[model samples]
Target: MEVNPLNIFFVKSDSKGDRLLFRYPYTTENKDESKQKKYGRHNPYAINSTEDLLQNPQSQTSNICKGQLSGFTDEMLSTLFAVKAELCNRKFELKVNDVRFVGHPTLLPYRTNKDDTATMILINIVFALQASASHSVVKCYYDLSKRLGKALRHEEKRCSYLTEEMKIMLAAHDEVSVLDSEMNGDNDDDDDNLRHSVSSATYSSENGADSSPKSAFHLILQRSSLARSMKSVFEELSSTGIVQVRINKWVLLSFCLPHKAHQIHNRGLIIEPETIDKCLQKLRPYHGILLMVNPNELLASIPLDSSSALLRLIKLYSPLKSLQTLAIEADLTLKQVSQLTGHLVYWAKATVIYPLCESNVYVVAPGANVHINSPLVEEFAKEFPGLCLLQ
Candidate 1:
């Protein structure tokens, strides 16, 4: 059914001017007279959507213009102008330009005629109306679009001014683990490790009523860097559990936090490795999740007592194996990653999920459609293969 375009503008409350909307559809038309003949403001306007935006496309305009334009909102104005535009060409909707943010709406219809034109036009009473370049919804949409465009350009300029490090880190946050053209260095570790290390800088005490599981992990890593290195890592891990594990460059220096074993014995996260001979054992029957918040102490090679804890970690892990959502921080060798992965399948038995990695892209975008360009994580994916399948 072809409804009069004017009906779209004049709603039930026309006298009150409850509706005020502005719309303009633009097509790229060359200013050159020669080219203009080939491509005038006709079909394929070079816009993404041609259909009427059911909800306000210029929602900000609608919101800003409501009750402000001669008491009409942007929506109402759009309807009115759409009707007027269709009047001349049923298929044509007026596309205006140069509109802007109005602190207070000004209904400056640019229609030409005597002032008496508006006075005579009572929907029931037929007559012409005076107008101006800035009067109708067509003009309003044009003006608003221009204003929005300028604001967007300003924002792009501001983002472009970001420091190189900020740009890299922020961009790296997206497309984190995917191997792509941006990668440049040797990827010795997996994306899982890269994401953890990069994300570590963002931790803060949040406002959740209870400390979330994520916070627990983040808080642990936020400890002093000493606690992150292998020697100190063992020192910190023991405080959390009874196994006082020691580490060396190639192997561990010690294992079993002799002081905390009773606690682990109490909690059953592990079966305390009480003796040098018994502790040298490789497996245990302990049960629970081994939340390896930071494994800087996890040496390249396992020490004697280390086996007992590893066994306990494994035994405790059997049930948690189904939770393969593993997260690790710190650069590690493929060999080191292999040891950890082996245990996940052999012990925890969990299916890994979510790839977390790094991006090395230069910028998110100038103003919009911004995306990430993680480089480190991408390297890890390429270097380590399926190691980060669960990242």
Candidate 2:
């Protein structure tokens, strides 16, 4: 006979926390699970954020309970008991003599050393005895966004390496949204860092409620007033735990596209090259060119002298080994940027993947050189900063 597939469910609760529900089928239910008395609270669905556990929980002192609420909802525990029940039939229970599944959960959010503070979680669930007795068991997990208490099971999601480019892309989209909201008179006091907001107070009473737990302050947050380019990519690096630029010394260079060159000329951020040098010095520790993907493009021109000056400054002060990827278009017809292009394509290990423009795609092997242009000028060079020599 075919077996029912075990399933898991996850729900993020209005940004404040998470609600994770789980269930699966088993050949035999454990004696231990049968003994678990129901929690008598009326709103059992109340989410428990990280703060709830770090601050308060009835079972806080218990090591087993602590283990269950770790960053991930001891997702493995469900599988362990399920697999055991399958193998041992009626005899399978947690804390059994021989556990069949010793391996870890396939999905883990936090790495070994990093601190994971994904707080405020919700897990709504129920279990019951099956009609037949091949020791058969059935479990269910429900999503809150779906029908009330109705189990909604899905195959576990598979995602990896939240890339630096992804971070920038997300930031860019969010920045535009925030800008639109600001224009539309959206209050500065809207949501927190992760876009979570708490609800207002309401009294409960059948016979005219008395005012108790009197409300004090209602706090809300506005979007941070920081430029996306200036939001400190280092903090982003810390959060994502992966880097944007992988610098290789010998291949480092800098160039401007076109319009930004006009911007520099008309509304220059710096009056003289010394001011520019100062800005570069401030960014020197980062060991890379300060860049925008579509800089000089669409503009008039950037004097070769500026590019020459920037290159000399980069070669001298910037971390020589920590430079690659220039964020400008190819405009200059001086020497062949082909060598730079070749190095970028082959050695730099860069593939020009489009996030939103995912319309047309071909899967290339990892560390593959994907060149979209011919031996001449690259067309979509802006999107593929992973390639193209400085203009």
Candidate 3:
């Protein structure tokens, strides 16, 4: 997904007329005339979902337009426009190119989530919606979705955007987990260990009743260098062939192949094609309806040169798919699609369902997708750590 900065404008009116002056801090030019022709005035970067339009009417305009936009609080909005008008009156440079001025989005609605994990997940979704570029938001969402899956231990709903149902589910899941732990006589250490092992980030103690999750998310986001962090994670995985996982953080960085496991340390664990099939059998009841996993993450991997062809293929068969079926739908030889799935299946990168080691088939967990609770999945997570589930 792309992360383009939106434009900002100052609207001024005198007795004679009204004038609109603008500045764009984050703008990208499409060098290819043909590509530009494809989108024209319509910026294809933004996804115009109904949820988006309802929340913010100004979102109807392209990010290139600079009057008013979403993702800003009322105070920030007033202050920014005031600054723009002042700058215009003084004939100073009216265009500000920095992201520093952009404030956090509205927080009250999303803070309804019961805990920090759910709250953070919701904030990330709002950020994705308000973010400028598509790819960057995609990356952000991809990582957040993984965190959500781990935190809630659910596969049916990964992306917890403005959806109220997900919030309720997450709260309920938390309650049930607590109840189960208490009933099972699990101690605080056990709970802490489980949370520590899976969480992406440690919850800050400073989050009081008055404090906002939206603000907390923005703080972490601002402090974070996501692109650099992503690059480092990618490089570390590529070079060392070792994936270190610390949940609640964006970079769990898990990736390993079946053959590669031997190079590291052997747990005497061997996953055959049949083992994968059995796992699929277990997961079939829940998530087998889909052909492919998360297409956004899969499509994120395709290079710009091959993206069009890959995207065409993805559109044709981007659903719950087995390797053989996808090959037929994509009109590609089985060998080609198999190779594609192999690259994508790493560390649950683009998947909602667990993938067989180096296979094109995928399956969602019956409840939480973690391997620790299930004998089969626990075996996988133990072996792979941060990547594919063991079961």
Clashes of each: 61, 13, 28
Model 1: lDDT of residue 31: 17
Candidate 3 per-residue lDDT over residues 1-391, each given as its tens digit: 1222233222222222332211212122321343357545786697875655546554233322343333433234334333322222121122233221221211112223357343322111111123332332334333432442333222223433333433333343343344334433464686665754343132233333422122222233233333223333334433433334432243243434332222233233333334434544443312212333446655674445554535755666534455565567677875565444443433233332432345565566455445456575756667578866542
Off by over 4 Å in 2: 1-235, 238-367, 371-391
Estimated TM-score for each candidate: 0.14, 0.16, 0.21
lDDT value for model 1: 0.29
Candidate 1 structure, TM-score to reference: 0.14
lDDT of 1 by residue, 300-387 (tens): 3344555453434433333233222212222333344335544432222222222322442333334422234555456557869876
> What's model 2's lDDT at 346?
24
Query: How far in Å is the alpha carbon of 270 misplaced in model 2?
Result: 33
- Measured by lDDT, the strongest candidate is 3
Clashes of 1: 61
* Residue 181, model 3: Cα distance from true site in angstroms: 58
Better of 1 and 2 by lDDT: 1
Alpha carbon lDDT of each predicted model: 0.29, 0.25, 0.36
